[model samples]
Target: MNTEQQVETLQSALLARARALADETLARAKHEAERIGAEADTRLRVREESEQASAKQRAERVYRQKVQAAEIKMRAELDQLRWAHVQQVLDALQERLTTLVEDDAVYLPLLKALIARAAQAIEDGDLVAQVNARDYTRLQAHWSTLAAEWVPGKRIVLSPEGEDCSGGALVRNRDNTIRVDNRFEGRLERLADELQRIIVERLFATATPLAMRG
Candidate 1:
């Protein structure tokens, strides 16, 4: 073979090697780009899922807060209604006592019982009894019987000063140091809490929902 032919062959071989290297480099670059794209897609999916979870938790918290607020408002309203009803029942009781005082047959026995109860509280002492104007005259007429039956062996003075009250009397010791109130209005007031509780129980047991009765 000649020198020219050998040179041409060598040039062809070098060109073929260069083309193979270029193809290999392009393939490596494409593989690197695909790997980077796949990693970015995976990161995007993870971020989206995390954001959705956080939003759901926030929604649930807000819902719970709203429910709690509504329950509080409802309970306050229910308490207000119960208080109004209790007042009405107490007013009715007061009206009934006032009516009973108008009947002499009922009022007389009740008044005597009141004086006896007041006198029993102060044993063996000089006591002054004060009653309403109408009751004072009647009681003065029956002083002998009342003195013997209720307060024996004690100086009992009926006050002409007379109180503005129901059938019962207010009896005080000699020096005005101790006093007993046996008035119908006072007795009722002292038991107001117990009366209100009873009223609530009867009303709720028959009229209200089962859940509210407790």
Candidate 2:
């Protein structure tokens, strides 16, 4: 009950209270630190997974784009090559055609064949052959023999007309009603496309691809 005894009791109680509060504060701080560490670890793992997925997606997109671009470029190059090859082939074919037409033997046979074809078309009567002044004399020398072979069952009289012609002869009756064209160059010029086509087919039979000439 004395003042000294009361003072000692109060001091001991205050010391015990301080020790208990310090222990509680330390435990609470440790618990908070553990929670914070777990949260940080979780956030790090999530970020790493997301970044990996994004990187994989980007890589796949780049690969697909590259592959597609390469395919398109390849097709373009192939088309260019194909067109170039076709143009070269056509140029060579034209040169070959010009050479064949300029040859003597080839031109002669072609002229003879055209003449015979026109002569065979003559009607079943007497025929008067009309030609330009240039070719009139030439036909006169060979008229009899040519008619004999050209028109087997008909008679032909060779006559030179005043009309201007490039080459070849025109056969007409006395009345000049029905006529046949047998000109030297005229007949060939008319049939130029067909003749060229045939010649090309024969000469370039072993070529890479057949020509489609118009």
Candidate 3:
């Protein structure tokens, strides 16, 4: 081949090689860009999924907290209601006892029984009997015979100072160290828990049948 023709052929060959390299480089660049875009899309999807999962967990936690708060509030309200109901029953019982104290015929026998019970509880015959102001005078009139029947051996003393009690008697040992409280308030106080249990049971039983209550 001639020198110019050879040179021209060399130039053409060089130009074709450059074009091929440029096309390959562009293809590589495009593939790299596509790979980068796919990776970015995957990362964005993963971040969104993670955020959604975290939000769901947070919402569940908040829901649980709300439920617990509501349960505690309801329990507190129920407790208050139960306490109010129990108090109302006790108040009614106190009123009834006060009415009983006003009736001498009904209360006198009860008083005698209370004194006897107190005497037995103290196990001491020589004890001072303390009563309410109204009962103190009545007890003074019957002291002689009452003492003879209840406590024969030991001397019984009726306190001139009235007790701040709702009927019944408080019998104390000779030195006033030991005492047996047979007063209405004292007895009721001692039995308050049992009375409250019974009252609650009855109230619930009436409101709901035993099977349904469970």
Candidate 4:
């Protein structure tokens, strides 16, 4: 063949080879882009799921805190109400005691019994009996006869000075070492804790049974 014809054929072959290389490179680039897009989509989905889980946990924590706070407030209010009720009962008991002291038919015997009890508790001592102003006068009038009947062996005498009490007697030895406080207020004070426990058990038994058990 002639030189011109041969050169044209070689140029055509080289041009076809260049076109084939361009097509292969374009296909590889498209495949790489598709792979990168899929990876990005997976990463985005994972991030969104993680964020949702964290938000749910935070919301749950806040809900628990609010519930606990409400429970604490409710318990505090109940405690205040229970204390107020207990105080009211105690005040009523004090008023009842005051009324009892005003009735002489009942109070006079109770006073005599209190003196006898105190005298018996002393166990062979020269005793001085102290009482409130009203009781001191009543006892001073017939102390000798009552003393002989109440405490036969012990030398018993009423004090010139009256005691500061509602009713009952305060008997002590001569030197003030041994004593028996049979006064109403003194006895009530000594039994205050037991009284409060009983009051709480009776009043709050149905309302807060678990709390009462504690």
Give the top-scoring candidate (TM-score): 3
* True lDDT of residue 166, candidate 2: 48
Which tens-of-lDDT digit does each residue in 1-214 have in candidate 2? 6999888888878888888888888888888888898888888888888888888888878877877777677767755665555446555654664465456467435444645555567554777766666546655787788677766677777775643654546767777777777664455566657765665555555646322221
Q: Give the runs in model 1 whose Cα sits over 4 Å from its true position.
A: 1-54, 206-214
The clash count for each model shown is 0, 3, 0, 0
Q: lDDT of model 2 at residue 38? A: 88
**Tens digit per residue, CA lDDT, model 3, 69-178:** 77777777766877789899999999999999889889988988887778777766678888989888887887888887776676778888898988888889898888
- Across 78-193, the per-residue lDDT of candidate 4 in tens digits comes to 88888888889989998887888889888878888888899899875699988889887877888899888877888999998888887888999998999999888888888889
lDDT of 4 at 57: 83
Predicted structure 4, TM vs. truth: 0.74
Rank by TM-score, highest first.
3, 4, 1, 2
- List TM-score per model, in order: 0.70, 0.39, 0.81, 0.74
**The 10-residue segment with the lowest total lDDT in model 2:** 205-214
Query: Order of candidates by lDDT, top first?
Result: 3, 4, 1, 2
Output the lDDT of residue 79, model 3. 69
Query: What are the clashing pairs of model 2?
Result: 168-183, 168-184, 169-183
lDDT tens digits, residues 138-176, model 1?
778877777677777777888898787766788888788
Looking at model 1, residue 37 earns an lDDT score of 86
lDDT of 4 at 15: 86
Give all candidates' CA lDDT scores: 0.79, 0.65, 0.84, 0.84
